[model samples]
Target: MMLTTNEDSQLALECERRIINAWPALSTLVLGDWVLRFANGYSGRANSATPLAYGAELDDAMLDMLEELYRADGLPPTIRLTPLVAEATRAAVLARGYRVKDASFGMIAPLAGLPVSEEAELQIEARPELEWIAGVAARQSGVKTHAGNLAAIVEKVRLPAAFASWLVEGEPVAFGMAVAERGMAEIGLICVDPAHRGKGLGRRIVAGLMGWAGAMDCHSAYLQVEQSNAIAISLYRSLGYRQLYAYETRILD
Candidate 1:
């Protein structure tokens, strides 16, 4: 059953909270523009020896922590806020004269009722064709494909448990990926080759990923998508996925 708007939003928030808490060491660091850059399993000492040493509340800690990030990076700092937490955090940022930008949606599914359309001609693949996937990403985003980008995603799939991909006629078409962690696999990097879109290929690929997650004994799958991508949002909704939360960022002027 499709979730109500309120239910979907709540689910999104819960998913964001879980993801952030699952990897506190990585999630706690604020990157270039207050972006929660690398939060799964990264660890390094902050620039300040006692940046987070105080037992202050989250907001206070974050505010104080921002200075350290700026001092370390030597740049005008920005902050990343997840929509689920934005309401609580926005006032604080505004108080600091920071404005928000770049809002995105966090969509998710429980892997129980993803509709697998029979008519879509989908061919499941065990591994992604790196060159093709990169090419598609580059074309869609106008960015050149780099070896490092491909390598990082490949390494992610090589983790102990991960999701697979789908192709059409031996050509890389769409992909869905997940990283298993703490009883759930956090889905990421789901993309459809623009050339093959509008043919229900995205749904097939997602369905295949859901099936893979279920076979691995995972309880649910989650992913983030930009809120502006209406087509994608609709497709996900048709496949039983729903928004769990929203994240927003404001580029510092």
Candidate 2:
């Protein structure tokens, strides 16, 4: 569904809140009314600080506190940004090296026209099993062995969250989640078993989540996907999802 500028802003704000709500951080700081999140080592979304909701320039104290906090956690302070973030703030980040990460698009699809597949029927659980968590962890770099962290994340997921998985003969082969809030659903963290990549398992997983969202009275489904993921982007487009907004993450070493 096409959104007006006001509607787009509202949707983005809603999704932002839903994501933060569904996956809460271990701690948070309010620097000049900006959000600074810490979630140990789970993922960038939980650990990286962002210049959101705060309009003024960042002060030295804020940066120093961030450095101290993340350093204590054994991580270099990192910042994540969306298109609305100030370019000046980005230019100011000190880093030994930098790289583009999660160069992503916020995409959404109307629930009215989503297609369903028999394969989607394979997803029968609203909550993922431990095997499902491990399947997703094994597919992600640096996260496979951190079962404790992954389990914590799964535990933190709020209600109305849909955890979907594909199992073959009692073993999980794919995993994904749909977080719904305020009439919108965000389908995220969809990963398939390396051995099952050539099949339509990814599509089936996403279709199942979207179908679930529609059934729950959600008006639209959305997600954040790295722009470089051409295959996944193609799948979502084929499913009638369109880009709502784009965000980029600049990693500092």
Candidate 3:
């Protein structure tokens, strides 16, 4: 079992809020402390319901309402279960036959001691441009069809944000972004060209983002990665990021 301190839980909640803000959904409905998000099936993080605040109990009535709302929106009723969720809430979903779908870990690292990268080929942009967006779509298969939605999501980020790209021969080969909220920064949408996988371009992009966040006066950085992605987990661990919490999506099929 994973152990977490009160400070860890609070930080996780803070990161979660930043993530939701940084990646805005097309439509959202707030029921008690739960936030039901819909993004026309673009991405799971933008489409699933998230329990942003703790201590709110989920009863069958609330579950039924959530199901009706999603059904009306042409989306499957999906809930993201995080560490802040109550054990009884998990049981409630299980009783309703919701099965586990995807699991991921929320990771954090302090920006104080991270080494700034010396890569001279990195380019930082105030906003994501066409070239950077196209590079990300070319690398991430899932984002190809949803590129427009992805743009809309990123455009809605109200906080300080930075888009980083690693260039090779004046062409972008890696892409990532950082959004700062309060004293923390959330990194997301990291992708690298297939030909540049083992060449440390991913690390450079991440380091560039962290360096940018540190310059923005952010004390900590956070990111979410699938639990099964060993390569990414290993890379983040090497950069001093530790697992702050784990979350899984439960889908009623």
Provide the overall lDDT of each model, using Cα atoms, as 2-decimal numbers. Answer: 0.52, 0.73, 0.85
Ranking 1 against 3 by TM-score, winner = 3
**Model 1, which residues run further than 4 Å from truth?**
1-14, 17-64, 67-76, 83-88, 113-136, 139-147, 153-163
lDDT of 3 by residue, 81-145 (tens): 88767789878888899888889999999999666666789999888898887778777766445
> Per-residue lDDT tens digits of candidate 2, residues 1-253?
2245877866766666667766667777877645777776688777877655423345567667867877887876776666445555555553324466567788888998554445733665666677767777788887445767877776776668888888777777887888777788888888888888978889888889898888778889988888898999999999889888776665656
Error of 1 at 198 (Å): 1.7
lDDT of 1 by residue, 110-133 (tens): 766444434344544445556545
Number of backbone-clashing residue pairs for each candidate, in the order shown? 12, 0, 0
Model 1 misses residue 1 by how many Å?
Answer: 23
TM-score of 2: 0.86
**lDDT at 187 for candidate 3?**
89
> Which is better, 2 or 3, measured by lDDT?
3
Off by over 4 Å in 3: 113-118
lDDT of 2: 0.73
